[model samples]
Target: MGKVLTQDAQRFMVDCLKAVGAGKKPALQQAELLIEADKMGHHSHGMNRLELYVNDIKTGKCQPNNECKILKESEATAWVDACNVLGATSSHFCMDLAIKKAGKAGVGWVSSKGGNHNGIMGFWARKAAKEGMIGMAFTNTSPLCPPTRGKQPVLGTNPLSVVAPGAQDELFYLDMATTAVAFGKIEIQRRKGKPLHPGWAQGTDGKITVDPEEASKARILLPLGGGEMTSGYKGFGLAAVVELFCGVLAGSKYGHHVRTWSLAEGGEPANLGQCFVAVNTSCFAPGFQDRVAAIMQHWRSIEPTEPCLRVKCPGDRERRNKEEAESKGTVTYLDSQIKSSAALAKKLNVTPMQVTAE
Candidate 1:
């Protein structure tokens, strides 16, 4: 593995984006989105995705400089066109608009279409939380999940995130995909030459399998519960609900129509759909933050079922990861990631990143 300073990693990402014709601000915003994921230990959405973004921009599948426009609006709702902009650009635009609207209307809801792959839905959700409001975000991705008992994949992992400020500097955060696991988990296991956990995915036969190789090739992700015996269909229902907030509401590519966005770059624009919502807590009774903090505190104080582990709230793990990463001032990448990143820099004619061994 190679360790790179976080700031330098961010710089390298921005440079790569710029090499593909993204403007300064857009490149930085997009890079920040990726870096934050790495910082928060969500490698699936972080630097692991830089190559895809670079290739998309290089191939004109994503327009980093395009301006998102509000197609229609009311006091509390908006319909937007991302104009094929980079995900971070459109996400920031919509989330900020939602926050502004919530300030006036008690709640703001925005739906957008024509978006590219937006990294980490939680990033946008946290934006509203920073403003002392409840933040919610959802987005549809390329289809990688099959409906229950079906042979072919149809729906996406389709993630949702909700975050809010809490009392005593605590926070409530939840970001999750409807699938049992992201396809990236399969890739990570495959890279390590390891088998997958049961229920993580389905094999070609559309049944649960533990072979990483087969699961990756099968590409049919199971819902959260895995199979009918485990009530996986309920997880499937939740995924459908997220789709309703995104592609169905935004009128973009829905369900099976969304294309598979693999590691390659030469396809049409993703044109994914997304939703961002913000609700003002001040609109409710007083002591909202205090109540939230108290609840989180109660959860944390509970006795652990296992002596080696302690109970934690939704945001606890991510917060700990962020704090640790900051204290170290560096992010570690797999040796494979370092090699690919160097290769990408050479391909894009950008300065390569410096790394520390150990």
Candidate 2:
């Protein structure tokens, strides 16, 4: 592993974005989104994706400078067209609209079309949380998850996220794809030459497999509960609901119609759909924060079944990851990641990330 200063990583991402003709503000926004993913231990959405975004913009699949516009609007709802801009840019536009509506109407709901892969859903939700409101976000991706008891995939790994602030400096955060695991986990396992866990994926035959290579090639991830025996249909249904909020509501390419981005780039515009919502907590019953904090604290107080492990609330792991990374002022990346980033920098004529240690 190589440790790079956090600021250096951010700078490299910003520089690379600028090299791809992204404006300064959009570049910085995108870089910060990726860096926050690394800080939260979600490396799949971090610097590893820089090359993909660069390729997207270079191929004209994304217009970083395009302006998003409202197609229609109501007191507390809106429909938006992202105009094929970078994911971060569109997300910020949508979430800002949601926040403004929530401020006036107590709740805001916005659906967007013609979007890109917005690194982490939690980032959008946190934007609302920071404003002392409950925030929610959802997005639809390419088809990767098959329905329960079905052989062919027709639903994406649709993800949903929710975030809320609580008293005593606590936060309630939940963000996850409806699949048992993200496809990126399979990619990591394939790169490491390790077998996948049984519940993580299925092979081409559409049966569960522990082989990483097969799973990666099959590109078929299991639903959140794994198999029919484990009630995976529940996850399948939840994924569908997420899609309803994004693609269906926003009227974008949905389900099987969504194009597969895979690991490579240079495809048509993703035309993905996304949803953002914000609700002012003050508009609800009083003491919402105290109630949330009490529940979280109670969960943490539960006796652990294992001596080596302790109970945690939903956001505990990410909060801890961010704290540790910030305390050290650095992030550790796989040697391969560092090398690839260097190659990306060379390819784009941008300054490479400076490695402090290896």
Candidate 3:
């Protein structure tokens, strides 16, 4: 493993994006999104994704310079065309609109089309949380998950996130993919030369497999509950619900219509669908923040079944990870990641990121 200053990682990401024709603003915004994921210890969505973004830009699959525009709108809802812009540009635009409308109308909902892969859903949802409102974000990606009891993949991981602020700097955060695991996790395992955990993915024969190579090639992830007896169908249903909020409502590419999960490779644009929502907490019951904080505290105070393990709130782990990263001012990456980044820097003709021995 190697460690790089968090700032250096962000700078390298920006340099690579700029090298691939992204504007200063979009590159910086996208870099911020990725860095936040690293800070929160969600490495699957952080620098691990940089090369894919660079490839998309190189292939003209993403038009970072294009502007997003509202296709239609009402007092509390808006439909937008992202115009094939980078995900950060479009997501920030739509989330900002939602926050503004929520300020006036008590709630706001925005649906968008033509977006590239956004790093993490929680990043967008947290924007509203910072404004003292409840926020939600949802997106549909390339199909990699199969329906319950079925063999062929038909739905994306279809992630969703919800975030809200509470009293005393407390926060309620939940971000999850409907699948048992995000496909990026498989990539990480493959890079580490490790096997997949049971129930994470299926082989070509539709049975669970621990071989990372086979799982990555098959690209068939199981739903959150793993299998039929475990009620995996519930997860499959949730993924479909996210699809409804995104592609179905936004009129973007829906399940089975989305491109295969891979580099851009001269293919058509992703045109992924996304949704954002914000609700002003003040418009609801009184003492909302206090109630939220109280519940989170109660959860943490519960006794654990295992003596070595402690109870935790939804976002506690991420919060602790962020604090640790901040204290060190660095993020650690696997050796494989460092090697790949060096190769990417050479390809893009950008300065390689400086790493220190750990």
lDDT tens per residue, model 2, 59-131: 8998999999999999899999999998999999999999999999999999999999998999999999999
Screening candidate 3 with a backbone cut-off below 3 angstroms (N, C-alpha, C), the clashing residue pairs are none
Candidate 1, 28-130: lDDT as tens digits: 9999999999999998788889999888888888999999999999999999999999999999999999999999999999999999999999999999999
Give lDDT per model, in order: 0.92, 0.92, 0.93
> Candidate 3, residue 308: CA error in Å?
1.3
- Which sections of candidate 1 miss by over 4 Å? 188-195, 263-265
Error of 3 at 221 (Å): 1.0
Which is superior by TM-score, 2 or 3?
2
| Count of clashes, each model | 0, 0, 0
lDDT top scorer: 3
Assess candidate 1 and give its TM-score to the true structure. 0.97
Candidate 1: which pairs clash? none
